[model samples]
Target: MIILKCQYLFNKILSKFFNIYTKLSFSQTGEDLIIQFIIGSLQLKKVTYLDVGTNHPFNMNNTFLMYLNGMNGVCVEPNPKLFNQIKRNRRRDKCLNVGVGINNEKTSTYYMMENSLLSTFSEEEANRMEKNGEAKILKSIPMELININDLIKFNFTTCPDVISLDAEGVDVEILNEFDFNTYRPKIFCIETISYSTNLTGVKSEEIINLMSKNGYKIFADTYVNTIFIEENLFN
Candidate 1:
């Protein structure tokens, strides 16, 4: 997530003299590291999480660092190819090869894009990606769907400590379905920037407002994503 974290650690002598202070965050931004800092400061020995639209296990993944640190949780990915890879590498996690949907649908049409990261269950989103020249739709498949509430209910006894969600364009829809009253996650790292090749990408204000209305405040905004912490956590 952190680009050139050791940006200052370059030159020949410096490289040999000092170890590169590498970036451990796998998030597109330094979201995982930020979340880790906050949660680690809480002094909890362990934490739990739920990663939605987990495209890759360790690449541009918001929850991978936590996994490496011994935190356990579930990963939901619709693309079977990606799911298999995550399941293989994240052996300790409960990897579910299914799409998250607003309603409890038996199955939904999932579009696999040329760039797997652009894949989505929303036909409109898939079409928009192709129309905008962001990516090409490689193929489509009927993937099983799961409700967010049901997901948390079945996977966790209480609620997970963190929910790192990046469901392409349906992220807010998923959040809207999350039973916040029943379960309150302490932190959330969500992809809040719209995808764009040019400089046309815009922040999702709706998401910011929604989180605020739910008594969460922005912990950090890295342009690509935003990290939120429940206000009560400070109390």
Candidate 2:
């Protein structure tokens, strides 16, 4: 009877431990969970990906998840400071220190907020903050711009299956720049933050419409990022 009681207690302990683990895993935000689910569905054992605006090479990234699953990709970051950090963490992936934009010529005066998270390519956004008494002037550096077509031709031997865009306030511009007829990525993860007192960018509905027009549908949405998949491919 003592042995059986001990076994029951052991089973209860194991059950409690599993429950805690499951709660922690599900506690991840919707975006992170969707990213994991998409990667799993893609069966990304050896596929390639492109991460635009890779800020920090943290473990929470879909790109990092790809790396963990034996996949490879490029991490493009425009911020010199952030790029260096990404390079340090993602030693195996190709890291490009250029901003992806519509034009190829270098542009200056891009404003970065004090917090860095509110950095943007839009001067209007910066000026608005200055008017509101919540901004500081930081020296802007000239950033090399590359379009999607150029990136694919220059960087990849073949086009990547997935492309994740996290450009602050410029997600739509970047999405529009891509010629979907020729280079339709199977999946996309884009950041769309609602307009707030401190933050300004494209809304979730706008991004959803743009993706829908391009034959993609919203797979999932979180506070920051939205996951889209090709309708025909996933339907």
Best by TM-score: 1
lDDT at residue 206 of model 1 (Cα atoms): 94
lDDT of each: 0.86, 0.70
Off by over 4 Å in 2: 1-30, 59-62, 103-108, 133-135, 195-202
Which TM-score value belongs to model 1? 0.89
> Candidate 2 on 1-235: residue-level lDDT in tens?
2353355456556778765232111111445456557767766555788988776675345566555445778998877887898888677789998887765545545566674655667777666766776665475667777787788878888778778787767778788878888887777888777445644644667778888998998887765677888888775
> Hey, what RMSD does candidate 2 come out at?
7.9
RMSD of each: 4.6, 7.9
lDDT accuracy of residue 56 in candidate 1: 91
